[model samples]
Target chain A: MTRVVVDREVCMSAGVCEMEAPAVFELDADGVLQVGEPTDLAAVEGAVRACPTGALQLVD
Target chain B: MSTPTLDAIDLSERTFWGAPPEQRHAVFDLLRRESPFAFFAEPQVPYIPVGPGYHAVTRYADVEAISSQPALFASGSGAVSIADMPPDLNEFYGSLISMDDPRHGKIRRIVAKAFTPRVLENLVGNVQAVADDVVARARRTAEAGDGTIDVVADLAAPIPLRVICDMMGIPEADRAMVLQQSTVILSGGDPELVEDEEYMVTAFLKAGELLAGLMERLAAERLERPADDLTTALVTTEVDGERLSHQEIASFFILLLVAGNETTRNAISQGVLALSEHPAERDRWAADPGLTRTAVEEVVRWTSPITWMRRTATRDVELSGQHFPAGSKFLLFYAAANRDPAVFADPHRFDLSRDPNPHVGFGSRGPHFCLGAHLARREIGVAFRAFADHLPDLEVCGEPARLQSSFVNGLKRLPARLTGVR
Candidate 1:
C-alpha cells in the first residue's frame, strides 16, 4: 500500500493535488491541506507528481 | 531537413520574435535537439543597457532541474528581466517572483492565505458572470456587425481584467485605467503598446507609479475599514508575526494586476485562435464538456503565454551535462520546454484530452512556480466553457496580429467570426 505524505512546510496550497485526486488530498476552508489514505494508487501518484512545490511524497 | 547553424539563429533580435510561429518553433526544436544550453546575447532595450548574455535552457529536463533548486539558481538577482534592473525598478516591478526565500517564502505564505480553495470557490460565480457578460457582449457585436469580432478585445481581455478588479475591490471607474497601465507595464517593448520607444522607461515608470498609487490608497482604505476583498485581506493578514506593509501591498497588487490580468487574457485569446485552427479538437471539446480541465491545460501548454523567465546561477553548477560558473544567467524557455519532443508525444499537436501533461506553462515544480496558476486555470476553463455554450461555431476569421515581444506570446487582435450566432 502507498501512503501519501504531505510536507506541510513545502506545500504552497496551489490545490493542484486536490484537483488531481480529490479523495486523497483535500484543502480545508482555512487552506490547510488534509491527506487521506490513498485508495487509488494511480490518481494518488498523479497528485504527488502534479504538486508544484514538490510537497507530496508517497511512502511504502 | 537540414540543421541550421547557430549563427543563423538570433533569438535576441526583435525580428526573430515577430517571425511566424512555425519558424520560431523550428528554431527551438533545433536548439532543443542540438544545443539545449545554447547562449545568446541579450536584446538591447531602449533605456536598459545590454548586459551579459543568457544560456537559453530549452530542454524540459534542464528547465525542471534548474527551477527545482532555488538555492542553486537564485531569483533575487532578477527573474523577469535578462539585464539586471535598477534598484528602484526592481522594488517596483520585482514583488514575490523576483525574490529569494525566506523573503519569497514568507510573502508567498501570507499571500497564499488569500488564494485558498475556499476563497477561490467564492470567486467562481464572479468569474462565470464576467465570462457570460463578455460572451454576451461579443454576441451583440457579431449580431450588429458583419458577424465578426476582435476576440482579444471583445471576448478574451475583459473576463480576467474584470475578475481581478472585482477580486481586488477596485471601483468600476478605475478598472480601465488599471488595464491600460498593466498593458504598458507588460507590453514587452511592443511598439504598438508602448509607442515612442525613446520614452519607454518613462512610460513604464509612470504606469507603475499610477498603479502603485491606486493600490496604496485602497490599502489605506482597507486598513481603516476592513473589507472581504483581496486587498483588505492582504493588508490585514499576518503570518509569523509579519504583515505586509503598504508598499509591499502596492507592489503585490501591481504584480497581480500584470500577472493575473495580462497572462490569462493572452491564454484566452490564444486559446480561441488555437480552437479556430484545430476545428477537430474544437468539436471534440464541444461534444464533451468534461474535457474543459485538460483543454485548459493544453491551451496553456500550446500557447505558453509567458514565454520565458530569467534565473541567475547562485554558484558554480553542472546542469544537463553542462558546466556553468557562478553568476551565470539562464533563461528558462517555458515555450520551448513545453514542446520538447523528449517529454511530450507529438509535441506540436493540440490534444485536448492530454493526461499526464506535466507542461510547465506555470513554471516547473519549484517555490517560484506561479502563485496564480490555479486562478489562471480556473479563468481559462470558465472562459472556454462560455465559448462552447454560446458560440459553438466561433472561429478565427483571419491571421492574428501578434504581440511583437518575445516575453509574451500574445495577440493584439484576433479577428474571429461567430458563425453559429448569425
Candidate 2:
C-alpha cells in the first residue's frame, strides 16, 4: 500500500493531484490535501509528479 | 440526428455575451440530456460565413476525456473560440494554447521554469499587498460618493492587471496600454471594444501584434538589464539548457496578460456577486474565516470563467455515441460541466461548504490547465478575506453590468459597496 503526503505549507490547491488520482487524493473543503487509500502506484506517482508546487509525495 | 431538446438550445454568436447564465445553463442541461456530444454549427454573422461547427462536449465525463486526451482532441487549431484561427494567428496569437503536443510540451517546460514554486510563493505577498491597496482604494471611492464601489474597475480588475504587469516587469506607464490591448483582443465583437463583426478578427490580430511588439521591446530590455521579475527571469532562465526565444517569450506574455488577468478578475467579481446572491453562504463564510478556501473554490465554480476551449479532432473519434471526424472541432463546455447536476448536488446553489468539488473551474484536466490557477485561487481567497475582515457589511450596491462576451463569464462594471448598504 502507498500513502500520499502533502507539504501543506506550499500546497496551492492546483487540484492536479485530484484530477490525476481523484480516487486517491483530494483538495478538501478546507483546502488541505486529503489522501485516499490508493492501490494504484501509477496513478499516485502521476499525481505527485503532476503537482506544479511539488507538494505531493508518496510514502510506503 | 436531431433531438427536440437539442433544437431548443440557441447557441449563436449572440448567445455568449449578455445572455444570462440561466439561458446558457438551460441549453447546457438540454444538451447534456439529449446530445451530450453533438454537432454545433455557430450562428453566422454578416461578413463571417459559418465554419464547420463543432462537437459540443457537455457532460463532465466527456469533457474530462477530451481535455485529458489532447492527442485525439488537439488544441493547436482553435484554442479559445468557436471559429478556426488563421495559421498566422494560431502561431502568433494562440501562443501556448495554439500548439499540439511537441510544441506545447516544449513551451510549457520553458515557461514552467519562470513560474516556479518560489515565484508562486512570492506572489502571495504581492497579491495580498495589491488586494489591501485595492480594498482601501475602493473604500475611499465608496466614502467619497454614496458608498458604492464599482468592484470590477475599483477592486477586482486592478489587482490582477497590476500584479500581472508587476510580475512581467512591465512599467506602471505601460500597464494600462497592455490592459487595453488584451481587452480589445478578447472583446468578442462587443461594440464597446470594436465596431462590429467585420472588424473583430482584425481587432484581435492587431491587438496580438501590438502586445507581441510591446513584449519584444520588454524582452530586449530585460535581456540588457536583468531585474527581479518574471519577465527578466523568462528572458534569462533556461530549462534543460534550453532558453526561450524573443517570440516565444512575447507570446507567453500575451497568454498571461490576457487569460491570466481576466480569469482572476472575473472569479473575484463574480465571487462577490455569488456571496451577494447567497446571503446565507456569505454569512457562513464571513462568520467562519477558515472556510475561505472552500469559499474561493465555490466562487470559481459558480463563476466558471473562461467558459469553453476548442479542440480539433486529430482522428475519427466517438464520445457518448456521437462520432467526430479527424478534422472536426470540439468545444468543451466547462461552464456546463461545472454545473453538471450529475456531479454536483443542487449545482446552482452557492454552498460554501460543498466538499469533494472536483470542479473544472480552473481546468486542471490537461496540459492547458491554467498555469496561474494557484495564484488566482489565492487572490480570490485573500481578496475575499480583505472584504470580510475590513468591511464586514460589504455587499453588492447594484446589479453588475455583465461583460458581453461568451468566452469570459465576466462583469464589466460591478457596483458594490464595501460597506453593506441599506
Candidate 3:
C-alpha cells in the first residue's frame, strides 16, 4: 500500500494537492491541510508531484 | 571548452528586449548552449541605484533547482526587479512573492484560505460568466465599428480585470481605475505606458499608492460591513490567532491586482496571438473542446509571461559548474528555460497536446510558485473556449504591439479581425 504524508512545516497551502486529488487531500477552513487514506494511488502520486512546495510525499 | 564570448548578447539593454521575439529567443539559445550560467550588468533604470550584476540562469534544470531551495537562494531581498527596491517601496511592494519561508508560509496560508479548491470551484462559474460577457461585449464592439478589435484592450484585458475586481468586491465604478493602475504598475517600463523614462519611478510609486489606497479603503469598509467577498474573508480570517493587518492586506491586495490581473490578462492576450498564428491548432481546439486543458498549458509555455524572477544567494554556493559568493543575484529566465531544448523537445514549436509539459511558466515547483496558477489556468481555458464557441473566425489581422519591458511578456495592442460571431 502507498501512503500519503504531508509535511505541515513545508506546505504553503497552495491547494494544488487538493485540486489534483481532492479526495485524498483537503484544506480546512483555517487552511490546514488534512490527509485521507489514498484510495487511488495514481491520483495520490500525481498530487504529490503537483505539490508546489514539495510538501507531500508518498510512501510504499 | 573555450570561454564563450558574450559580445553579441546584452541582456541589460532595453532595446534587446524590445527587439523581435525570434531575435531574443536566438540570443537566449546561444546563452543556454554556451553559457548556461552567464552574468551581465543590471539594466540602468532611472531612480534606482545599480548594484552588483546578476547571473542569468537560463537552463531549465538550474531554474528548478534554485527555485526549490529558497534557503540557499532567498527572495526576501527582492524577486521582481533586477535592481534592489528602495526600503520605502518595500512596504507596499514586498508581498509573499518576495518573501522566504515561515513569513511567506504564514501569510500564504491566510491568503490561501480565500483560494481553496472549494473557494476556487465556486469561482469557476463566475469566471465562465465573466468570460462570456467579455466575449459578447467584444463582439458587439466589433460589429458596431470595424471588424477589427484590439484584442489586448477590448477582449483579453477585460476578462481577468473583471474577474479579479468582482472577487474583491470592488465597486463597478472603480473597475477601470483599478485596471489603469495595475497596467502602470506592471508596465515593465513600456515607453508607451510610462512615456517619460525620467519619471518612471514616480509612475511606479504613484500606481502602487493608488492601488494600495483603494485596497486600504475597501479593507476598512469590509471590517465594518463584512461583505461576502475575498476582501472580507481576508480581513476576518485568522490562523493560529494570527490575522492580516490592514497594511499587510493592502499590500497583498495590490499584489493580487498586479500579479493576478496583469499575468492572466497577458496570457489571454498571448493565447489569442498564438492561436491566430497557429491556425491548425486553433481549428483542432475548435473541433475538440477537450483540448482546452492542454492548449492553455501550451499558451503559458509558449508565452512565459512574467519572464524572469530575481533570487539572491543566501550563502556561498556552486551551481551548474559555477561558483557565486553570498549576496550574488540570479535572474531565473523562465522564457529561456521554457524553451530549453534539453528539457522541451523542439520547444519553439507550439503543440497543444504536449503532455508532461513541466514548463516553469508558473515559477516552477517551489514555495513561491504562483498562488494564482489555478485561477489563471481556468481564466485562459474559459477565454479560449469562448473564442472557439463564439468567434471561430477570429484571426490576427496585424502584428501585436509587444510590451517594451523584459519582465512581463505583455502586449499593448493585438490587432485581431473577428467574424462569424455567434
Q: Residue-wise lDDT of candidate 3 within B327-398, one digit each (tens)? A: 999999999999999989889999999987888899987889888888898889998898888887787889
Model 2 spans with C-alpha error above 4 angstroms = A1-60, B1-5, B43-49, B238-242, B418-422
Candidate 3 residue B238 C-alpha distance from true site, Å = 3.6
- Residue B16 Cα positional deviation in candidate 3, in Å, after optimal superposition: 1.6
Candidate with top DockQ is 3
Misplaced by over 4 Å in model 3 are B1-5, B239-242
DockQ of predicted model 2: 0.09
Q: After superposition, how far is residue B207 of candidate 2 from its true place, in Å?
A: 2.1
Model 3 over residues A1-60: C-alpha lDDT tens digits? Answer: 778878978888899888778888889987889899998788888898888888988888
Clashing pairs in 3: none
lDDT of 3: 0.86
DockQ of each: 0.61, 0.09, 0.85
Instruction: Tell me the tens digit of each residue's lDDT in model 1 across B1-422.
Output: 45557778878887778777788899999899888898898887777888889999999999999999999999987888888898668766978888888878877766776676557878899899999999999999999998999999898889999998888899899999998899988887788988888888888899999998898789889999988888888888776786876667878899988998899999999888888889999999988989988899999999999999989999899996679999999999999999998899999999999986889999998998888887898899999998998888687889899888888888889898888767
